[model samples]
Target chain A: MRKTFNNELSKMHVRFAEMGMMVHEAIFRAVKAFVDHDKALAHNVIVRDQAINECENELEKMTLEVIALYQPVTADLRDVITILKASSDIERIGDHAVSMCNATIRMKGSQRIAEIEVEIAKMGDYTCSMVEHVLDAYVNRNLERAYQIAKDDRFLDAELRKIRQRCMTVMQAAPASVFSGSYYISVATYLERIGDYVTNVCEWIVFLQLGEIVELNPSSKNNL
Target chain B: MKVKRIRIIRTFFSDAIIIFIFLTVIFLLVIRQVRNGSVSAWGVETFLLLSVTAIILAAVDIFGRYLRFRKRKQNLEALNSRLSNIIEGTKGKHVLLEPSDPYYELSQSINAVQSMKDMISKSFVTQQRGYFSLIEYLTIGVMVLDQDRKIYLSNHAMSDLIGREMNLKKQLYVNVLRTYELSQLIERVYQDRQDQHAEIKLDFSDKVVDAHVVYVPVSEHHFLVMALLYDITELKEIERMQMDFVGNVSHELKTPITAITGFSETLLQGALKDPKALKEFLNIIHQESLKLTELVEDILSLARIDASPELKLDEIDIRKFIINLLRPFRPEISKKDIHVEIQIPNGCTVQVDQNKLRHVINNLVQNAIKYNNYKGNVWLKGTIKKDSWFISVNDNGYGIPKDEKERIFERFYRVDTSRSRQNGGTGLGLSVVKEYVEAMSGKITVDSQVGVGSTFTVIFPLELPTAPLNESTK
Candidate 1:
């Protein structure tokens, strides 16, 4: 029975890594679309988000199935629960990358302010790398790296705020540039939102290890 | 193991009890004979009793002495404790037990032998340590798995190659080596017991390694599989880039040459009499010829550099250099109506090959002009950074795709095929720019966003790197 549980868990692990890879590719391609202005890659990331969402639902079902079957206690229970929570957060991350792709699609042919664009790109980079590191931390159960990634969320947030301020200035100074500037603002915001989801994944990792719910980035925002 | 010079034997208290009973029996018999006072010939009974007592006494003495000597050496723990002190070079242990003791000489010999074994084993351990360190410090990753497929040993390089902590021992190789390709390769090696070589991808990242696994047999029943992994990710990347270059060269050559041949063949067959067709065909021929010349010139330049690439370095002010480089682009810049902004600090200078730098700067400036939207802004900022100096060419134009970003420097790689062809780009622009930058001991990086624009930065170091240059020199 223990072997059965372990095998199920290993299968889940492989699935989870696959989902992580998919999300990673989505984030990468989404950023590429934003950077390269490739609508096809943007549409691809958008289409791929459905698969990611399905992955999350499937992951949730697997966890519930493990709970129904083994009714595991302590660490075993923590493992299933953490994965369930973290996979949801990853789905959210994929969703936000989709939002960036949506923003990329909408921003088409509008004038781009370089200053705001660079900040938005910076946010994309931070989001891409954080998702990568956070997934690794979860797989390796590296609490220190998870904590470092939690700290990294603040940088993404700062870039988001900075881009918003810059976009506001661009909007006021040149009303003509506001169309693409607002899209840039939205893209940065989505990246920051992705960073929040990454922090939540970090929280699940901590809960998996420490066996208690703890917030690595305790923010008053994202309350909704 | 050292052969024992002295044999070991142990006697128990039960043997002492049996000996006591036999001596008592002899005493009783003697007592019975004496008490009975049998009338025998003179002193015959007396002589017999005396001989019996003397024989028994001699037997007991020999047995007791042998037991005492053997018993002293019986405790292996005592011998180990004695030898440990000697091996440690401590003064507490004596080579010879107290000289007054009956078995002191025998103990001395055993102690001498014990110390000799200790020295030999100690040296063996040090030699083994040396071999272990050799594997530990090897640049190529090495792992040895026993027949059970457990990781018998792995080095630091192994961990670095896989980008994981794998210093653990006796772990199943599959558990440590996450990639299916690597694990399957190891399994194959174990099954065939033959040497195998492969290029395996690390699943998480695009890291490639040249893997060589050897089946090492220790005995009939025992064997090991040794895997040597050297990271060839960079090498594979260069190989791919060169392959793209070669493939592009053929494709680039074929297109215009085919157009030239077809147009000329059409003119030769029938169209010569029709002035309109003649003029059109000749124009087509002329255009294709121009393209052919451009391609040939680009190819020859690359070949010249490939033959013996040299750098002639000189110090030039950055702001002045950029403005001068932008000289050729002024007419195109105005035609595109680009808002060219140069924010390089005055007196900012670098030592670089002048002609090569001119080519590098010109390629970037021309790209900025070609790819920009009407009234698009071109920003050039020169900054002297620690360890390196850089000038970034930032443009508000259609940016490169993320996937194609890595390949953009490859010859004939165009993000937008139609746009580049429309713009009359040979696709060799970035490739030549990259080559010249590397030849001048520099680096280049591009950051771009789809609709937003692109930034191309050419960086040169403050100090020459001691290590050799990249794939070009090789």
Candidate 2:
């Protein structure tokens, strides 16, 4: 009886991982689109997120079914529970990427905002790495490594803030540049928000790894 | 009845006395008659009376001897049965008596001796079974000593535990000590007579044996001692595992938290005066804070699953369930340019805890999309087989390694941990999926190869039970 239960759990894990792959792809392309400023690619990222949403729903249903039937214990129980949590994070990550795409579309065709793309690109890159690192941390049960990625997210935020501050100063120096500066700020903000989402994923990873609800940031680091 | 039997014997004695008196009276009468010349004298009559009296006395003596022997035989048989029962693995108090079966005073003294004997026997057996059983069965080493420290019982397990068979009888338990700790315990229990226990550590075997001893006072001058044993090898291993788990979790949580808190503190101290620095700090703070939230949420979910596994369950249609779930993700799918195909029979239902099952299905489907190739098509299929409904989500993505598949369900376990994080996986997804699936009495499996793609299947048995309805209630 226990063997059968374990077998069932194995199947569920595979399915969850499969669904995870889709969201991972969506985010992957979304990051690429942000860097290349390819409208078509950005559109693709948005479109793929729908599949991620569908997967999120389906995986949740599967996990619930398993819990009802098998009543797994110890590690098996923890695994299913972690999947339920991970799907949300994965789905949210997909949403954030698509949202970024939307932001890109909004800021498109505005030449004045083009210069800020560099900073936005930097932020996007850092956010992308954060997203990737947290996913890996989740899989590896490397809570330490996962936390490090979360810690590294600070750098991405700092870049976004600097871009935002520079855009404001430019707007103040040349009142006519207000429109352009606003776009820069928006892009910076979007990148910063993406970083936030990535951190969210990491927090869940830590929780999943440890089976405890600890703050991802150290208590002493909570000044912000 | 005994009094009546005694009365009958007394009556027989009186009757004999009366018969003697009558015979004497008859003789006198005959003598008188003969003297008077009324009758002829007869010697034969006198001889017959004398012979009958002799026969009656002999029979009484024989009967008395027979009664005495019968009583003694009954008493001996009762005593023998009691002794045998006590020896046959039963515990209690019973007295042993001397061989003499008659005389009430002597019997009482014998009973006293019997009590002491039983006490000694019980203590002996208890001690041998308690301590020797472990040494005999679980380990190799067999050695036991009596109160005087004489060897009493030794088994093969004891020999193995001790590394050799050693005669332990008649020697002081302390003086012959192979291990000082064990000897000390024996001495302590012997002196105190109260319950005492100790752990005997073995350096060679790297094992610990728990030993317990108790002194039993059987009489004013006699005492009995007993000991118990147990092995804690497996227990020690579990302790080590628990410690490792804690250590790993602590370090993992500390790093990120430190960065977030430290950066925030630095910004607050004076960085805010510079808008750029302040904004940068804020951004970092925001990101770290979000990560902390996710971590907390994951931990909460894990704890919830572990603590109250008996969540609510309900019947849900498989086809409708999948369809309803898909409604929310259509936007994401369109944006990703991914195609999702659903193959499920209409009206097929499975019993499941809705919240948990939704989580499982959501995790798997999301993965399919997140890792799929550009413009990849995901097949979501459901079928009924025997008593269960099988559902699968197939994705065309970089699949998992064969070796990593089994370990994937472990908490925080990952194949390519770094890449998994890159994909925004918390690693808890598959593990949680496994836990809920098992709890629901369902089965989940994965078929995958690196780069070939992966197929995940979930089998949920028919869960809604049919109940007979009473027309009145309806």
Candidate 3:
């Protein structure tokens, strides 16, 4: 019975790690679609999110089972708890990517691209990097790096500000460009959301390791 | 000690009986000698020796019994102190006793009881902490009263709500009885040991606090009273805003919609013969369609922000960011007589969702420029302090009213509704700012007065590359 419990726990950890990786990949692929304007890639990312969603459901069930059956404690319990939390965040990131995919499809419908595409692309890239780093941090238990990625979102905000100014200018010059501007604005928003989910995942990772939840930023330490 | 006393009494009785037997034997021998008219010296000597030995042995036995009794009494007193300590020790943890101790079974049971008590009190402490923290965090006041009508516990929120502790010793219902009808209901329930609920408006200093009271009998001698505070100030404002939103949408759209429908009706009735009328009707219809589109877009954006105010943060270069931001606004800068100054230092970075952050900054700067007089200056500055980054936008424009400063962030809130309408403001910009700023773990504050200028400053964390501070981590 003990051996079986151990095997089941290992299986759950493996599945949770896979889910985190898939979310990381989805975020990257969605941003790539935005940058490259590849509708096919966007469609793929949108479709693959279903798999992540399934993984989330399965992880939740497995975690609940472990808690009920084995009644694990300390590190073993922390592992299950973190997986439960991380899966939710991963699912949300997938949903955000799907939203980005929908935004891309909308932009395609309008067939109008804005002049501030670079700014939007940069924001997407930065957010994707954040997701990738956070996932790696979770797998390797690299809390410091994970925290860094979470804090890095503010820099992304600065880039988005520039994007907005460019869009506003375009809107003022050509009133009809408002639709295109709002679309790009939403794209920047989706990227930012992806970054936030990554940070949440990293936090869960640290919590699993330390049995404590610490703030990501130094300034915000006062909050804790 | 009682057993030792019994032993002592038995020893004294045994010694007296032995002494009586010895004396009787000696007396009988003496009587025989007197009858025989002669006595032996050895016999007398033997009698005397036997009597002395009995007396000495009795004295020693008495002293020994007294010592044992005293020792037993002292041991009993020590045991009582040890038992009391086990029950009410200062340490929260419990310790088991050895099995060989005199009160081993009792000690084990006591230890078991002590352990259970520790668990209960630990959980109770945890719950108390959690409850008070929630109350303190909430913008509500809660008070718990005993059956005697005295305050047993009051949350910090409740204290802040009532402004002072005047009602701490008094009947809670009596204090707010005049302000709310619900207080009387609570009083009735508490006095009668029945369930009661009430809603009262509390004057917490200048601000009015809407309080919902629920009185539940927790025990025969104690009652639980909960006061839920809903800062109706915001709720009332939201209600007004919703009314204005509906009113504004209808009023704004009615003009064009009415014109289009009427003109179409007229044209259908043969007014199409006149080219002027036909062109005018078509123009009105086009304008109305545009208005509908704008209204739909505003509604959609507001809904989106309200539904998911969850914006993510990422890292970006501050110097390049500012340069990039200003590049597009160059035209606005050149066309208008406004001076746009960026006072942010190079390499300054923050963590926030790039898009929402941009939206807020763009809206503020745009508003500043839009409201500024000709040749006016709009200053955009970012300063980093010990723990946070403060971004300020100052504009010399039509200032806001003191009351409106706080309400300006409400959806569809406007200082001058007419002027805002003329400027094509949908009144959702500041509300969006507030939502995004708060979502990004930042605070937005505005300092303004009538006839003076307004300065809106957004303060966010500086070490934001790792994570934004939120309640979950704490």
Which residue window of length 10 is worst by lDDT in model 3 chain B? Answer: B172-181
Better of 1 and 2 by DockQ: 1
Please identify model 2 stretches exceeding 4 Å from their true place.
A1-224, B1-252, B275-280, B327-336, B464-474
Q: Kindly list the per-residue Cα lDDT of model 1 for residues A36-106, writing each as its tens digit.
A: 67788799889878888988889989999999999999999899888888898888888888988998888
Q: After superposition, how far is residue B357 of candidate 1 from its true place, in Å?
A: 4.3
Model 2 lDDT, residue B59, Cα: 50
Tens digits of per-residue lDDT for model 2, B1-474:
033566556656665666656676787687886697444554667657754774485357546755775676566555555556546745444444444645444446545656777778789889977856666565534355555544555556554454334444554333223343454566576557676777776432445777766676678876666555556655764575466446545544665689888988897788779989888888877887786677667767877666656647687888889888878788768878998999888887666788888888898998888877667778999977787788899987656655457666766565665566666655567878887777666778998654446799988777533342122112
User: Mind sharing the TM-score for model 1?
Assistant: 0.67
Candidate ordering by TM-score (highest first): 1, 3, 2
C-alpha DockQ for predicted model 1: 0.25
Error of 2 at B425 (Å): 3.0
Off by over 4 Å in 3: A1-224, B1-18, B21-47, B84-141, B146-150, B159-255, B296-425, B428-445, B450-453, B456-474
Best candidate, lDDT:
1
Per-residue lDDT, model 1, residue B441, is: 76
lDDT per residue for candidate 3 within B412-447, as digits (tens), equals 667776577777766667877887777676789997
Task: Put down candidate 1 lDDT per residue, B1-474, tens digits, no spaces.
Answer: 222333212232334445555665675677668877544433666556655665566567656766676656554445567667666765455444567775676667767776677687789989999989999999889999988767889999888877666777866555455454576577688668898899986634556889999998889988889999988888988888788778777877888889989988888898898999999988988988899899888877777766766677798999999988888777888888899999999998778778988888888988888998998999999889888999899998877765677788877787787668788868888988888888767889998766668899999888755554545454
Clash totals for all candidate models: 4, 152, 24
Which portions of model 1 miss their true places by more than 4 Å? A1-62, A73-79, A98-113, A132-186, A202-219, A222-224, B1-205, B208-243, B262-284, B308-325, B342-357, B379-394, B399-409, B434-474
Best candidate, DockQ: 1
